[model samples]
Target: MYERKPVQSWLTDMDGVLVHEGQPVPGAPEFINKLRSSGKPFLILTNNSIYTPRDLQARLTRMGFEVPEHALWTAALATAQFLADQRPGGTAYVIGEAGLTTALHAVGYVLTDFAPDYVVLGETRTYSFEAITKAVRLINDGARFICTNPDVTGPSVEGALPAAGSVAAMISKATGVEPYFVGKPNPMMMRSALNTINAHSESTAMIGDRMDTDVLCGLEAGLETILVLTGISTRTEAERYPYRPSRIVGSVADLMDEI
Candidate 1:
């Protein structure tokens, strides 16, 4: 018989761990409700920079999850916080939705096209070639390049759509300058998520659906990693990576007892 360690603090990914294809994963709400009732800190982590915490909360609510707006943490918020620390009161030329723009605005960053401090890229419904061309020119003209996440594509009803990383690559290819990617697979964003809840890596458990991003983020950030098969990653796919998750479950439904 094996004795499972207790979860002191928890972090779970949004898309596949809790909900899949805009619907709540079976038992996700119960798991979340357990976390909420237990009095321990928890947050749903997302690499998406297109929607704000409030937006996510509402979406989750519509899907039957009662997550608070504060219970969600996004890559956009982390990127804005990073920029604020790195270069305070700076200007940028941004390509993103309200989530990215709002986060930057809260951090006192001004958005402009002319002689900005950075050319920040994020997830958007449409990636305009004209905007990307301008971004390349901005990089050539000494503006630093930054991207919210490194996800090359995102899931859609129609299939995977080109996302922030893909657009960033285009700009980089044109300008011969690589943009700094701040979302998962990068440990900084994980650290920021932990910091947001004042949680320690040793005691915190990170539940994610993807091995490359979620598991990697947790492992690199020094947190225990759990991989759920409810999303894009599979059991065999997880093994292909050099790094392994601390545990792998079929779905969030299988995690109730452990938590």
Candidate 2:
């Protein structure tokens, strides 16, 4: 069992914690509104790197969330930030959606079709065999492999779909190259989220639905972890895990009773 603690800042997951299958989870909006009203700064952190912050903000608005652009952070953004810090001005061979490409470009990276200095992978609906082959060849040619996240799948309107990790793993197996992951459970992602709020680990809490990624990431980063059952992990499943959250709630609405 885990014990609850006080927190000054929050880093929250989006898909499972706030919404599911394009619909807002019950009490998500209220919980967020309360956080905002209380002046407890929070960021919407997500492993899905297919959309930019602006795109995500628009989607949240469409789903009736009063979200600001700066409150959003995606794996794509974190990956770009990490790459920019590691190898600035490098050309990248990208296998992801427009958002990942856009983030890389914003970080002063040039996107190329061949012989890139780095190979970047994320979520892409149009991923093809040729793209995978090209990425593998580039890795074999000495390009650094960078994966936006390690999530094998994410919830979607149709159901769970293949995420970036699955594709990255396939390429890694083919080329015998492991990638530097930039999403949840990785310290880099947690660091980026903390920087957004200008807070330290002691003052921060991670509220999410998944145990493997979100809860584990929060624990690794030394932040209080709050698990909400509104998403993927059920109470039964969560109980079976060795690593438990500091607190567990039925939904975001239940947060009202806490903070």
Counting clashing residue pairs in each candidate, in order, gives: 0, 0
Write one digit per residue (lDDT tens) for candidate 1, span 85-156. Answer: 999999999999999999999999999998999999999998888998899998899999999999999998
Find the candidate with the highest lDDT and give its number: 1
Give the least accurate 10-residue stretch of model 2, judged by summed lDDT: 1-10
Q: After superposition, which runs of candidate 1 have C-alpha atoms over 4 Å from their true positions?
A: 1-5
Residue 69 in model 1: shift from native, Å? 0.7
User: In candidate 1, what residue range of length 10 has the lowest lDDT sum?
Assistant: 1-10
Supply the TM-score for candidate 2: 0.95
Q: Which pairs clash inside model 2? A: none
